[model samples]
Target: MASSRGGSGAVGRANELEKMSIEQLKALKEQADMEVNLLQDSLSNIRTATSRLENATTALNDLSLCPQGLLLQTLSLSVWVPRKSKKL
Candidate 1:
């Protein structure tokens, strides 16, 4: 059940809208449309970021499963790390 406190219920909103002038209604509609657009754009960006993260994770998993020598060759590395400098 919906609460009617603070004039937040649908019936309360309808009564409020009924008291609003035409210009006020127009402005409210414009503001609502802008908010909807912003929300949709945010959703799209989140989905794209999620997809890119998934692809990167899958690629990392594939790389980890590759043969050790192949992995080293692909990285073109002769050693995992250079020997510590004797002077240090």
Candidate 2:
């Protein structure tokens, strides 16, 4: 069995970090907030990419435009397809 540091090792360090003085905690909070904002922005970008991919696939299937349009057309297709549930 692995010996626990009684919350004094890496986990302990993280706990201590959360309990630092107000000033230090505030600084940490600012950094964490910035990181959260960055992650949110990244998540938004990923969602956008996924949306574009889905749109392109739909357009291609609909024969609305050539595949080249998805790669080079200035306009973007941004429609969603509704999936129907099959009755078992």
Cα lDDT, model 2, residue 23: 97
What is the Cα-based lDDT of residue 10 in candidate 1?
A: 71
Off by over 4 Å in 1: 1-8, 69-88
Q: Each candidate's lDDT (Cα)?
A: 0.74, 0.72
By TM-score, the best candidate is: 1
Instruction: Give me the candidate number with maximum lDDT.
Output: 1
Q: Assess candidate 2 and give its lDDT.
A: 0.72
TM-scores, all candidates, are 0.69, 0.55
Task: Please give, for residues 4-86, the per-residue lDDT of candidate 2 as tens digits.
Answer: 66544879788898779999989989999999999999999999999989877876676564443333322424544443445
Candidate 2 pairs with clashing backbones: none
